[model samples]
Target: MPTTNDELPESGRKITVTEAVRLTTNWRTYLDDSECDFQTKAFLIPIASIKNLLAINPDAEGVRAYIGLNDADDAMSGKLVLVPVVDGEDVIFLPGSNGDPDVENDSNVYDRSQNCPPDCSTPNELNP
Candidate 1:
């Protein structure tokens, strides 16, 4: 079944327009099934728009966004889904013709705060 945007919960934290854009554009897959195809370009617009909406309000914590396929189309449709995570146990199903999208949450969303400067964590950083 396709998840409607109305079904998704609103974020509790206020996300900056810039941060939201970054989130979608720089989205890293925490987990992806081999079969699910990512429509990178197609999804970028919706991802950015949704992020912008979330950014308006701060304090919406634990909110993650993802782009998944609709069963009807294998191509990326730019459908942005707002996924909420609880203690990292949210199960997400990727839109597919067959099996439901795999579910995984919070524990999967990347933490930007922990990102270290290039030189701090990598040997290349030290050399550079």
Candidate 2:
């Protein structure tokens, strides 16, 4: 089981990854606009390409992505949203540097373990 809201200074609330996914039922609603308005190829890592590479080389280092997916067994849909945390009534993903998309697009996916930056060395604290 994954930890959620490991160190949220904003709310100081602890959460589980399952709960976070449940809260973000509409995670994909704003993705189109966000991608169109502020996007760069830097943050657009193709999932298929990664899989192909991994298949060829089993020793390959896989991506450390934090994806927001709907857990409804009846309907399956998921998108590569950034690291998300339960904040109040909303579940939000951290935007890239200065509202750009390149930050999350990097090869290093945000590490969801440990506390946030300046406090803990765990990486990828985009919105913490």
Candidate 3:
């Protein structure tokens, strides 16, 4: 489901605007089925207006903001989750040169579905 400006949370969205306008977030997703954990959620917000409303620099390059499921400050494990947007449309998160998902707590080859962040994009950029 898409998150419209009207649906923006009443709290935690630190930006405030005095004008009357509807800012709909162009929400996209790279949800890796059977991957990730309960500690996070990942998606793309591409609408320039919505980005501005969220206090992100609309002119800034790349998607650098992520909603934190634990802290609500757009990060998990002290890292920022960044997804890729090409031509204003969201693409799959590409992994950085280094990525290591933690399944060691109960590591199992069959449990590979739980490899967090889907082995794409660095740990923080793609993982929920």
Candidate 4:
């Protein structure tokens, strides 16, 4: 059973082509319905970054994605913030460069992902 999001399964499941297409189609519908002009279809995150985030806590179950905006007033500046999740909850990191585990801070999160548009996949079934 999935501990965090009820929408997600216990583990990664392989879906059929039809299912994949349906999911993508639904996502597209959402973008259109929401009037998302800057339809950011995907984000490119480095594997090393993910590894580093996971290294912060050996018991990390997974990384949670948070919708962010560079400029809170601008919806066009949409971005994805990644945070390590432990025990079905986000792990708040320490404040400052010292990286002390005791001190808690909300700013301690990852957002190295490149949003699609200028940085995107070569028109695949998912991003088409």
Q: Which candidate gets the maximum TM-score versus the true structure? A: 4
On lDDT, the stronger of 1 and 3 is: 1
Q: How should the candidates be ordered by lDDT, best one leading? A: 4, 1, 2, 3
**Which portions of model 3 miss their true places by more than 4 Å?**
1-61, 70-79, 93-128
Candidate 4 Cα deviation (angstroms), residue 80: 1.2
lDDT of 2 by residue, 5-67 (tens): 654454446766566555443333354456533211113345554554355434433333454
Worst 10 residues of 4 by lDDT: 99-108
Please state the error at residue 44 of candidate 2 in Å: 0.6
lDDT of 4 by residue, 6-121 (tens): 55665655566788888978987898999866677677888877887767667877888988778766666768888888789886563235666554443457778877766877
- lDDT at 43, model 3: 35
Q: Per-residue lDDT of 1-128 in model 3, one digit per residue for the tens?
A: 43655665654244433221112111112223444343333333335434432343333234434433434453343233344444675433222322334532221111101212322335432231
- The ten-residue window of minimal lDDT in model 2 covers 84-93
lDDT of all the models against the reference? Answer: 0.39, 0.36, 0.33, 0.73
TM-score per candidate, in order? 0.26, 0.19, 0.20, 0.73
Worst 10 residues of 1 by lDDT: 110-119
Candidate 1 residue lDDT tens string, 1-128: 42554555564345565776565444433213334454242222335544643454233345565644344464443344654444564423222323333433212222222111211333331212
Name the regions of candidate 1 deviating beyond 4 angstroms.
1-39, 42-60, 91-128
Per-residue error for 26 in candidate 2, Å, reads: 28
lDDT at 100 for candidate 2?
43
